[model samples]
Target: MAKVGRGLPAPKSKRRVKYGPNVVRLVCEDLASGMTYNEVTQGRGRPSHSSLYEWRRRYPEFAEATDAARAFGAEVCGDRALEVAEQATEETVRKAKLEVDTLVHRAAVLAPERWGGRGAGLRRAEPIEVVFSVRRFEKVVGPDGRVCVREIKPEGEV
Candidate 1:
C-alpha cells in the first residue's frame, strides 16, 4: 500500500490576466458607468478586485482612466438611488429603500466631495422617505475573552 505524505500546500500558480483592448475598455466603462470594483468582479468570469487594482498600478493609462471614472460612477449611483427611491412600490418599498441606501453609501464612498461627505449622507434630487435606526449597547469584555453585551441605559449611562 502506498502511504500519503503530509506536506505544505503547493505554491500558488501565477494567474495571468489577459488585459486585452476589450479588457481595458470594459473595465474603464464599468468604472465610468458607476460600477464599483466589487460590482465589476461580480460579473461572470470577471477578474478579482485585487487583480483590477494591480493592473491599474502596473498600467498608468488604466489608473488614469479608473480615477476619472470614479466620480462618474459615484454620480451614477447617486442618480440611480434617487430613481429607485421614487419608483419604489409598497410591496418593494423595503427592498428598494435598502438598495437606495446601498447606492447612496457607495456613491458617497466613491466621491465624498460631490456627495457632501460622510455626515451628510446622500443627495436627493427630490424629497424621498429615508429610514434610519439607532441603537445603544454596552461592551463588556472580561478576561474570559468573550464579549458581554448589555442594553445601554437611556440617560447616557451604560
Candidate 2:
C-alpha cells in the first residue's frame, strides 16, 4: 500500500508513474526511432502523456531529447513512406499504399511548415488572372518646366 503524495496528495505534482533513468533514455531512443507515443508505451512501462510532459518540463535534457527524437521520427516516417511506396508487393500493394500515405500525412502533420500537406504557404483563394498592356507615356514638359507624370503601383494603384 503506497501512501498518497507523501503529504495528503499535493495533486498536480502527483506522479502517475515512476520512470527510471535508463528507461527514460530508452524512451528517448524509441521516440527517435520513429515510434509513436503508443508504441513507446507498448512494452516500456507505459507512461501517460501527462507523465511524459511533466518529465520534459522537469528535465531540460529530456525536453531537448524529445524534440530531437520527434524531428528524427518525422524524418523516419517520410523515408519509410517513400521506401514502402517504392517496394510495395502486389498482394499488399493497397495496404502498403495506405500505410505509406498515412506515414506521409503523419510526417507532414509532425512538421507541417517543412513537410506538411498542401505546402507551407498554400491557401485557398479565388483564382485570379492579370492582364498587362504596356503603354509608353512620353514626357511632356511645358515652358514653365512642368512635366506630366503618373505614378504606377505594382497592381495599378495610383
Candidate 3:
C-alpha cells in the first residue's frame, strides 16, 4: 500500500513547463481562428485555462493593435466629413464673392459717377410716364373710342 501524509499523496515533481514563442503563437492563432475556449484549452494540452485568458488580458501590444484598427476607421470617417464641410464652405464663399462682384459691376456701369468720384453731383432726369388710367373718361360708344385720363403721383411721393 502507498504511504500518505496528511491524507494526501506525496509530492511528485517540481519541474515547470517552459512555453516558447511558437507555443504562444499557436495559442494566439487558435484563439483567432474561431476556436472555442474549451477547444483552445484542449489543443494547448490543457495548460492552465486561466493562464491563457490572463495572457490576452495582460498583453499591451494586442490591446493597442485592436485600438489602432478602430481609430483608423474613425479617422477615415472624420476626414471625409471634414472634406465635405471644407468644400461647402469654399463654394459658399465663392458664390458670395461672385454676387458682390456682379453688383459692383452693375453699379459702376449704371451710375459710375456715384462710386467713381468722392463728391460727384448726381444728374437729374425728367419724370418717366408710367401708366395711363381710364377711370376719369366716360365710355363713348362708337365715335369717341376711349378717352383715357393719365394720373401721376406727387413729385416727392415717387
Candidate 3 regions with alpha-carbon error over 4 angstroms: 1-19, 43-46, 62-158
Best by TM-score: 2
Model 2 Cα lDDT, one tens digit per residue, 49-143: 77788888998888888877787888999999989988988999999989998998887766665677666687667899999987555666778
Candidate 3 lDDT, tens digit per residue, 1-158?
76557688775443333445565655555544434446666632444556555555887664454334333333343344445445555548776555545544433433355533345676757899899754333434455676555445555654
Each prediction's total of clashing residue pairs, residues at least 3 apart in sequence or on different chains, is: 1, 0, 0
How well does model 2 score by local distance difference test? 0.77
Pairing residues by index, what is the TM-score of model 3? 0.26
In terms of lDDT, model 1 sits at: 0.80
| TM-score of each model, in listed order | 0.54, 0.54, 0.26
Better of 1 and 2 by TM-score: 2
Q: Tell me the lDDT of model 1 at 108.
A: 78
**Candidate models: Cα lDDT each:** 0.80, 0.77, 0.49
Shift of residue 92 alpha carbon in model 3, Å: 60
